[model samples]
Target chain A: MKSVMIVGVGGQGTLLASRVLGRVMLDAGYDVKVSEVHGMSQRGGSVVTYVRWGDKVESPVINEGEADVLLAFEQLEAARFLPYLKKDGVVVTNTQQIDPMPVITGAAVYPEKLIEKLEEKGVRLTALDALSLAKEAGSQKAVNVVLIGAMASSLDIPEALWIEAIEKTVPPKFLEMNKRAFELGFHA
Target chain B: MKELLQGNEAVARGLYEAGVTVVSSYPGTPSTEITEAAAMYDEIYCEWAPNEKVAAEVAAGAAIGGARSFCGMKHVGLNVAADPVFTMSYIGVNGGMVIGVADDPGMHSSQNEQDSRNYAIAAKLLMLEPSDSAECRDMTKLAFELSEQFDTPVMLRLSTRIAHSRSIVDTVDRVDVPLRPYVKNAAKNVMLPAFARPKHEMVEARTVKEREWAEICALNFVEDNGSATGVIVAGSVYKYAKEALGDTVNYLKLGVVNPLPVEKIRNFANGLDKVYVIEELDDILETHCRKIGVEVIGKDLFPRCGEFSQKLIAEKMGVARDESVSIEESIPVRPPVMCCGCPHRGLFYALKREGVYVSGDIGCYTLGASAPLGAMDACICMGASISALHGYNKARGAEAEKKAVAVIGDSTFMHSGVTSLIDIAYNRSNSTVIILDNSITGMTGHQQNPTTGLTIKGDPTSAVDLEALCRAIGIQDVQVVDPYDLKATRAALKAALTAECPSVIISRRPCALLKTVKHKPALTVDTDKCIGCKACMGIGCPAISMKDGKAVIDATQCVGCGVCTDLCPKKAIG
Candidate 1:
């Protein structure tokens, strides 16, 4: 079984990213289970979604130190959830910083050098300014696609399959922008 | 065709395939999507009732009128709908009726962590719990069939894990089911003491027969893995045990949780070296095992409060996870808060400034109790704010009345707060209630309600007039104020607090996240005029933060509500 973890702040389109991942895995004729948090937690809170695929998936959750790939949509979330990644796991992170409530309230300061810190931990890391790439792709909301593109490159999945999954998952109006965003991160 | 479906979505699909014609539900987290998904099917008639009680009664009425019907709500909502459910137990359904109740063990989106299984046993309703989305679909169809076959209403229990999780589900065509003709039998349909006496006898007889069914039902089965030790479990907890223990332990998975089989469980435990019963929240299963004269281990190793994870189960059961290495640094936490330009922000800010004891209700407004705002004193449940506020003031007299207020959302005010407000008026206890009318249900992902002037299907409907309703119920000092206008909101709140009679101030503004509501360009801060003083942080808006001793607003999140603009002493934010 391969376990993938998607971590980000709420309202960052992580749900859409998980849906695309679910689509790709299902198309490969693998049993898949995707778990998500909804309602109150989605209101500007730190949120995590799990996507697991195998011959027969048992649990929908990915426990601590069990994830094969950790996809972070923001820098702070990546550092906070690093423990979920395995010793030999791959990290695909967007170097975008959105200060959580404690930071904004001056109760705590936001940490610095997160990507560098993760890289220093001796893990295979793919880091990028996904927000800027997504903006260049015509919509900042496409950051999820950008990170998915970076994570896709690490896995043995084909680019055509990812594109096909994106095409099937995203709405018609945002498909063009997401495709460009995916390409930018794929080659980054 | 095989498609991925959330458990809630699969239940909706099952409702469609079961030939259900009536569906009524009130929106509650983890359970709202079931009715929302069911409404898409034209063959089914769906509506959002005002409360879970109304929804249950509507479903029961439909069932009694000879149509398959269903209603879904959260666990606490089951308490509100329990009156009908218990009675529906005595008055057996003419057509099948199913109730879907989602329990939040960790209180993810709920105010309390309540288990809904006890409600099934108390109501004498047969309940089936599914572990995955595929079973969510399968058991739902089976629930409708069992409701008919057993001549009783069936309850389908779900939790946050199962309801929100998506898994592979094979779709099937709708099966043709002929509706049973309604027969006028006063003794069975009416539940007065005279008619209910005979029905009471029927319920006892039905339980004995159902126990026989539980013994050999396919939904409750054993998987022999040739292991000495075994685990007995149900619902989503089964998945955790399966992943943690694997084939090292034998399994007895029960889909029908209520009225657990006695002989089957005893047989499964006879040869096992150790028998462990794994359940979340309560020890209902463990208690049942002891009653059936079966020795099992549960609740001793498991905490009775919250959820269970695969890691926790593995640790307790003497299993080991991979010895993995990763980062161990701690970071700041991100809590749910009022969104940027949230309509509730200004009202909560003004209330916080007044230093009043604000009784809060559930919704996005409940976030008022958190963070820098920290305005609300107590928040119990959906409509507790108004009623609890009245009791609070009555207990403390005029001293507390002048220093307290109840803040509720528009949808919540419609749900059950109306009667609470009336209690204050009739009893002549002075109380101030502020209805945060954001024109829609801001929580549970924006479901349409009576106050929204729309139906579940987005059709126009008769909207409830809050002002007129208050006046008709003898509230003289009724006022409306836009929460965006801070000065006016404060004035209205002040006037109501000092008023002699029970007063109501409607804080009217549409939710910023509403699609029809457009946001202006993000406000910019002039650094030259900006002072180091942090006056704008009091609202706790997620968009505003300090950068180099200056207030900075993220343009992406800022909706330009300008509530912070009024707080700036230096005229820095505009």
Candidate 2:
């Protein structure tokens, strides 16, 4: 069984990334279950989704320290959900930062040196500026696809299957840009 | 073919495949998508009823008219529809009726964590709880059949985890079942004192027979895996236990949670060395086990609040896993906030500045109670704003009328606020009401309401006029103001509050998140004239922040609502 945790601010396309991953796992004949946060939590709040796939899956949530991969779309969110990762878990994180309400209102300061902090915890970390890479692919909204591609590099699934899943999941109007974004992150 | 489906989506598919003809529902989290998805099927007629009570009655009326019908609502919504739900159990159904009530156990988006199983028992209704999307689909179809066979309304209880989670489900072809013929029988349908007395006895008799049938039903079965310890679970908790214990323990999973299979539970417990009951929120199953002379371990080892995870179950059962790591540094909280250009922001900001005691209602506007805004003083439920405001003024007399107002959204005013407005007019109170007209239901992901001039499928419809409705309800003083224009809003609020009779101020603006709305240019801060007074931060707009001791607006996040610009004392914002 494999478990992946996607963490990001609300409206950052994290849920779409999980949906695409779910489709890829289902196409491979694996039993997949995806759990998401909805309602008030989607209003510029921290959103986390759990995707599990295996021969037969039961629970839709991942236990603490049980995630095989952690895909984060923001720097603070990546550090916030670090406890969900296993000791040897692979981390594919975007270096983009979106300040929380407290930090924005001057109640608190945004944490600094997040990558260095995670590296000190002895986990396998791969951090990149996915926002810039997505822009290079012709749309900044394709950052989720970029991170998904980076996460795909650590898995045994073929790049073609990921691309096929992306094609089926995204709208056709922006398909080419997302495809380029995925490839750029895959080779990052 | 198999497809990934949310639990709510599967329930709609089940309703479609069961040949249901009519469906009605009011939007609420975890339950809204069921009706939205049902509307996609051309075979069924679906609608967004004003409130849960009306939705339930509409489905019941359709059932009485010889159509298989269903209605969906969240846990609190059931409370609003309980009057119909409780009586419908005695009246029974003519065709078939299924009520989908999704419970929020962890209170994720709800005001309270309630167990809907108690409602089923109180109403003496049969209830089915599904753990996954597949069961959600299969059990919904079965619920309709059971409703017809037993001559009763059935309840399908769903929790947050089960309702929102997605899992693979195999699609099934629709079965066109002919509608049962409707016959007028006052003795069964009417609830007058003499007629209802006999029907109550009949309901009790049916419960006894249903319990007997539950004992042998295939839905309640045992799985023996050679382990002595046994766990009896139901709904989403069953999935959590299965993941934690695997096949090492004997299990009796119950799909029919209400009118529980007492005999089956006893037989299963007799074969195992130890019996344990696993459930979330409340100890409904544990209480039943004790009443039936069965010993069980529950509640004492498990929590009775919030949700249950696989790890928690494993730890309680003494299963070992690798020790979990923890982060040493504390992280800032990221609570949900209003959108960047939310329509309610300006009205709330004005209300706070006026120092008026505001009574709030449900919607995205309820965020007015959060820090920075802090305008709303009381929020009981839907439509309580108007009614509560009336009572507040009557108690405090003329002084309260000068500083009190009820703030509600357009959709919510259409829901139950109109009735309360009538109460204020008839009883003679000097209460002022502010209707924040955001043009759509801002909460529950912007579903269409009566005031939106569109149906669930987005076809044009007759929109309810707020001014005409207020006049019709006996409120002569009615005014509409653009909430974006703070000056007009302040003037309208002042005139309405000081008025002698009941008055309503409709603060009109479209939700900024709607795709059709165009935004003005993002505002820029002139640092040369900045005073760093932090007045602009009081609105709690996520787009504006204090950076380097000066107000700084993120151009990318701002939608140019410009409400914050009015707060700057030095005119430093443009």
Candidate 3:
């Protein structure tokens, strides 16, 4: 893939997703570069991570309209980052909407027609309620892994590599439940 | 593989893997982890110095001794280290010296948004901006190489974005770089007037050589496009610019931001009619280009303050704002405060009540300056509290001095407050110094300090004794008081303030959030005994709320610290 975009709010696993993508790509013998948001966004704001992989990565940043895939942890953030994807690019998104500060404070409205907008724009969109799936898998925190699993299943990357990345990335305690959530998300 | 790590943790890992040998720094946001991480490696010698300038000087000394050294600080801390940074540029270095400056662009955990890049330009040092965690690692390793190669210390700039953001970093086995043997050369090492005058001339020639050398540096690469609108940007801004312009604009992505490669930059600007420089902070890049007789547009469209996003760049670039613009509603302003059971609360509450002048220093205790607490008189920087209090006392007379105190955090006291304490003792001034010993560097996310016996990885280490240090500093009287014990705290403050000689009062308490610190069972108010004197309200605990014209305690929120129990005039809360 030329580029991948991970979208979520602060405290979500967007950073993890970008790292996993970077590692898997690096292991596959592709040069990879990634960028992310830090600082105040860690307090709960929109976060977007960029991962670009190919031969000859120079600047470690992806240009606009160049992302081959947009992996979104939240639906609205997915639509928000839709333009980053190439024309008719694929998007794997969790059907969850995290109310940003503005939405929580009533200054803005959370768009209800996120998937519809992406689909109408000729983008291939797959939406899943990863939070519910994670809850069903016995941990709400596995939502990130579930989203990663969904991306891994649909994006044609090896599922084993993604799982290995998850195992390496997460702490030892919650590995089993996270793996289960990933399996459920992959098949869904 | 992908890892779940805090931004500070990643920076530590980066420094460790970079083969850094000597690390000295004062703790500040977004930048504290680098030194903490350096401490983890057995091969690296790391310590928290008293202040930023001292930290920088220590690192500079180590570099001259032919060892790879580093100093990390937040932006404001850079202001303290600015003296060494500017002078070291002229003196140069024997080994690579990297200064890690993490800037809080939007004032996240900082008092101001001072761009550290301005420091790089003013000091004539090379600056490198890493966009993310992986680069935070890569640029750091590369910074040492560039610093040694150019014989100048390099500044590694991290914004709140890269410093606090986590991402997967490719790990490598540690390569232990032995400290090169030092050769005594007083004229080269020392900056006496005669030796320094010659070095000043060398700096100008060195800049020219660096400019030429930057032309071939691997970090600055050009992305060729058939288009004429080429954009040049460094650091995080490159991410947004690439998102907004894409192939429509050719790019000159400069990883090494300072000592602008005149030849390389001119080559890129040779054909483009409308070239724009995209950067987050001050337009140092644009100013350099303008001086070289190149017309560039930068700060004119983008902002000089705050961070930039794709949408922000798109709107500035005159593109339609994307659907992401309306993601969520604006959040209410919920400014950060001392935690629910914080021991510092009672002390600040007493300070507010007594209306005493307080010259504050850095630490979680600085939250005393926040509204509803309103206790701190001034917070200049680390180690400034005691000295500022001394000056304030000299100006205000004995009565004001008797009521005033210098409030500093425990880790901050260990960092730089000791010297000022010695200064007061030596000068025979009657100044009260309150060390708010919270047992951790609470402001930088509760990292361990010299006073705490724990390392960054939570390993047990030797803790420093504050009372013993005070006694060793030549103070005849040293008293330790539990901050939770308000009556004792007030008495200690009064005694320390009124003492005929310099006195140290250490208000010791562990942070409420430490795992070992257990809160009392939440308190419940007996409404029958409530008199609504509002004394309980004075503590400013969110757990204490008003109900039915009387003070009520939300048992769920209260930690049962009974801070409010003492505040209730009717003794209604149990």
Which predicted model would earn the best DockQ?
1
State how far residue A22 of model 2 sits from its true place (Å): 0.8
Q: lDDT tens string, model 3, B76-139?
A: 9899899999889877888889998998876767777888888887898989887766777778
Here, model 1's chain A TM-score works out at 0.97
Superposed Cα RMSD, model 3: 6.4
lDDT of 1: 0.91
TM-score of chain B of 1: 0.99
Residue B292 CA displacement from its true place in model 1, Å: 1.1
Q: Cα-based RMSD of the predictions, in order?
A: 1.1, 1.5, 6.4
Query: Highest TM-score: which candidate?
Result: 1
True contacts kept of each: 0.75, 0.61, 0.05
Model 2 ranges off by over 4 Å: none
Off by over 4 Å in 1: B326-328
Candidate 2 residue-wise lDDT, B118-207, digit = tens: 999999999999999999999999999999999999999999888888999999899887778878899988899999999999999999
TM-score of each: 0.99, 0.98, 0.77
Please give the ranking of all candidate structures by TM-score, highest first, separated by commas: 1, 2, 3
